[model samples]
Target: MHGKLTPGLDFLSDGGEMGALMRAHDWSTSPLGLPERWPQSLRTVVSLMLTSKFPMFIAWGPELAFLYNDGYRPIFGAKHPHALGLPFRQVWSEIWADIEPLVKKALAGEATYHEDLHLVMERNGYPEDTWYTFSYSPVRDETGGIAGMFCACTETTQEVRSRAALKEEQDRLRELFKQAPSFMAMLSGRDHVFELVNDAYLQLVGHRRDIIGKPVREALPEVEGQGFFELLDRVYATGEPFTGSSVRVGLQRKPGSPVEERVVDLVYQPVTDREGNVRGIFAEGYDVTERVQAEKSLRESEARFRNLADHAPVMVWVTEPDAICTYLSRSWYEFTGQTPETGLGFGWLGAVHPDDRAWSAEVFRDANAKREPFRLEYRLRRADGTYRWAIDAAAPRFGSDGSFLGFVGSVLDIGDRKEVEERLRESEAAFRTVTNATPALVWVSSNDGNIVYLNERWYEFTGQRMDEAVGSGWTAAIHPDDLGRILPYWQRCRETGEIYEGEARYRRHDGEYCWHAFRAVPQTGSDGTIERWFGICVDINERKRWEEHQRLLINELNHRVKNTLAIVQAMAAQSLRQVGDGSRPELQAFQDRLFALARAHDVLTRENWEGAELREIIHEVVEPYLRQSTRHFEIEGPRLRLIPRTALAIAMAIHELATNAAKYGALSVPSGCVVIAWTLVPDATPRLVLRWQEQNGPPVAPPTRRGFGTRLIERSLAQDLGGEVRLTYDLAGVVCVMDVPLSDEGGMLEHQSSH
Candidate 1:
């Protein structure tokens, strides 16, 4: 064996094995120790392999003493040392359990060769199932009987487990891919033919179920020119995954119509083999039409918001949670003369007025910490180094995760408005001071009659506080008797926007009513609308009392003057009667005429010399002389008004005429009738024409006496009223006519008649 072996073999054997092998190359030194460098177990196994045709192993009792060269070290691993001399049951208990029956059968002299035997054994910590064409032949001793069994085996664990795992993984992938909601498919080769298609893919492409294994273009002839086939080819050739979001694809049916397209998100993954060569393409996609449209609309909405913020009159800004300015509109730069970058961080604080810096910072800090909206008014330093009032407001912004991201805010310049407010305050203060200093009560009321403002004088006078005086309650202090009249006037002023002046009594602080001359003037705006009313009330109680006393005194003087006139008329009548001829009848007539004049004066005085009713004057002066049956009189006229002087003159004239008629005309006969009719003349000169007509009496004639009766009628009517009187006595009757102006004896009566 050594001579036949090459140098490579000699090196494997070693020097001691070569020497021993040369001495007893055939008999003394057997093939067992010829390869002395090898272990006894391997040398014995190799020597047996020359005779054994089958792969085999030799074991002593329970220990496997020798295994064939076909068995690699991998089969034993760390169990090699223990298996060389240990009992087979102890060394490989798990394997012994399966081989024990076979070993026993072989030992009973029944030669056995098990073909394609399946055995499960433990190698190291792993349980391995192996397939083997095994032969266990009895190694007979010199008697040619069974001594020990030889075993031959092969492992098939890798092929069996690999086939099983591959089948399981393929089944799992198929089930998962089919159940997916999204469209999925495998395209084979550069032609992009569909090798596999899930249910979702078939549904998406509107394909029949049986066409799944067919090429996509062949199955759906409608999709020939579509871009999707080309896209798949590119992905396959490149051996790279392709992704598309919302890639539109038009259907082939109607090329000119509105394109029927779907927004889809697609991904193509290249399937590769063990050699890293691209084989097929796997595509997964979803319909994202609604989501794509919604995203577009959201972007448009954000654009609109940006436009509004940019163009708004106020300065708009956004800041981060750390108070760093993130955004500022153009208005901010225009107003503050500071760009957004200049105002980043706490740089915006520099623009704040020195007086308002501390307050602004405090408010900013508090709002940021608490994540609340902030609103405050402060002054900001302008480009001109002047400070202007500004209203700053900010609302905190938050992220979807409830983090305080930042804030959105606005700044409005109110400098002009602030100046106007200050001026208004100064004016109001001055008005209040002036009104309070005055002795008269002053108030300002709304157009609706609500008291909006009042001076101290009003409160002092009413014994009420400012609260009580405001609104309609201010009227509570007004005397009840005057409220009716004053309230109407006040309302009129409000409606007409006029000045109101009236005298009324108002209650004082001491619960006494005092006469006050109240005046209110409505204040109007440029549009001619009444906004409010400013009023003043002065105390007039003392003056009113004095005027009342003066009126009484005047009335007494008028009475005395009337009495004196009556006496003068009486004295003149007596004196005339004495100086006249001894015609007793004429003397008596003269006395009667004087008496009539005296009676008229008395009637006028009774009316306070104001005026007298025409009918009343006629009845009073005539009833004393004429019996009801002997004289009949009628008075007819519209209700007419006469001035005091005109009424007196008319009354006296009527008395004189009635006296003469009673003495010498109509009243002397039972058939007599007298009619007194007066009509108002409508003209610039308003006059009253009165006629005293008598009839059915003895022959009538004018009085020859030229006595006081005739003179009195003529003078009273003509001198006092700028008119004339005529008396005529005829055979048929006597008639007297009087015409007078409506005024004091002149055309001034026209103006007087207006009253």
Candidate 2:
């Protein structure tokens, strides 16, 4: 029905570009015929539509021939040129069901309007989610009968999606504010209007529910005269943040309650808009009332006590129940030249001769734990850093109600008496002869705890003369780090008059440090006063190393157990996702892999998990299947050892291959067989090559897609053993090849084990 067409009619001539396309278009392939035969109303409507700039489309006749203006052409996307004259239903078949009702309504002379309507369309090659706001109206004929529909549309996808995203972000912000731990609120404008308030802020203000739209002055009127109002005004005018630490404020926490005093650490930060103009304030703070009150009470108590102790002749001190020094009298500070701040909380220990501090702290802590009165003598550091002997006595104090409070102590200087004892110890010639004859190193100290003598063995082992090893000079032979700990314990034992036993690393005559156990016993006079101390040193280095090695082995075992459990967890999680509940083929396959791993572990465990022989791993995995069928498998490989990780990976791979053969390849047939072999390639870096080839099975072809077995073989071997694997489905058989690095832990153990 091809013919030359003339277009001189009023409607045809008036129609713009689309009208020209419809008139010149071929109608043979369409349900609608030539334009000359189209209804008068349809031609008139198309003529008016093509000249309009607004997006508009028309569907004409019972067949609903589609027509659109140039402004609406982009709505067709890639469907352009051909969509102009096509039936409306076919042109937009993907969304035809969604829009057909609206088209029918318009044809019935009932107009419809939609705002932000959701639609999924495939105007292009692929479907897209789209939103539109449009109106549909009926087009009339000369007989005043509705023939078709007209649409004026506007796309609203971007606007609608942007609004939804903005709302979601606002909700997220509100949730964050509501759950914040600190009291937080947003105040807007110069009046500090409460724009938003979080739960913590509401609780802070005594749970007042109606405070959100009110100014801070109206919501919290009690804070007006507390200087907080002034602070807010200053911040709003200058747009600078204000921070207050432990600031006192008066507040009415409830509707009809008396004003209460509270302390708070607060900050008022300014929030700015896109233009960099500050618009509102963000208030954040935490209440510190209890901490502030406790500190105030402690200061008052310390002031009253210092007045009485400052002029006391003896040094005085006080400690908390935990043995942390809380206060020291003026006499004690003057004697040690340490400030109250430095002397508090175990800090005063720094003034003790470094060697004696450790032992003194231990004795003091022990006495406090038993809550008993005790007396001890130790060297203390004078203001000039000279060590002086001092005797200290302390008694635990309790309240009138018998509740344990803390300890109160006093100290007396005893350096003068210690000098007299040193001269008496020097006159004892018989004591030196007996100690010098012993093989052990020996030393003696005076009543004042100063070293007075070193035996011949002591001088020989330390590579020092008697003079150099006497007094505090012997500390030079003690390792620097060990001296800090050992000196304190030795001094404590001397002061407490207890048997001293301690360990230290002492520098030997050869310049190497070795551990030694030192023991000392005090000889006291009839008056119960210590006259001298006798000590001996013995080597104990070998025992220390043996203990350290045992610890390392136990830690390594724990790490391996944790790693194995994690691997099992990952395998179970993946298997459960694929198979779900009940027994299925996927579940059975996972069980086989799990059992293969267990058998590999059993072989390694038998060897203490250091490693296992490679042949053992293969035999364990394949033995079960080989015993069940008449088919046989040829196994041959060098006797190489495999570390725990490499052994497990190989075991799993072998199990997968054997199972596949049983299901669809070699082992499925009576005459089928499998050959497994491996060889070692030696060099600076050795490698192991393993091959699995099936034979005498049904003709094989490569699978169309990968299965679970293929993925496992490829991923596990590469990750666990750092190996490469290639699986090929040959026409006559299925073959697999693998290459793995050979580490010292997985090197050859013996010759081939063939079966």
Could you tell me how far off, in angstroms, the CA of residue 167 lies in candidate 1 after the best superposition? 52
Model 1 clash pairs?
59-65, 62-88, 721-745, 722-745, 743-749
lDDT of each: 0.71, 0.82
lDDT score, residue 672, model 2?
91
Q: Model 1 — TM-score against the truth?
A: 0.44
- Please count the clashing residue pairs in each candidate, in the order shown: 5, 3
lDDT of 1 at 233: 79
Candidate 1 lDDT score relative to the true structure: 0.71
lDDT (tens digit, per residue) of candidate 1 on 622-654: 767555665788778766655556666776677
Can you give the lDDT of residue 496 in candidate 1? 76
Best by TM-score: 1
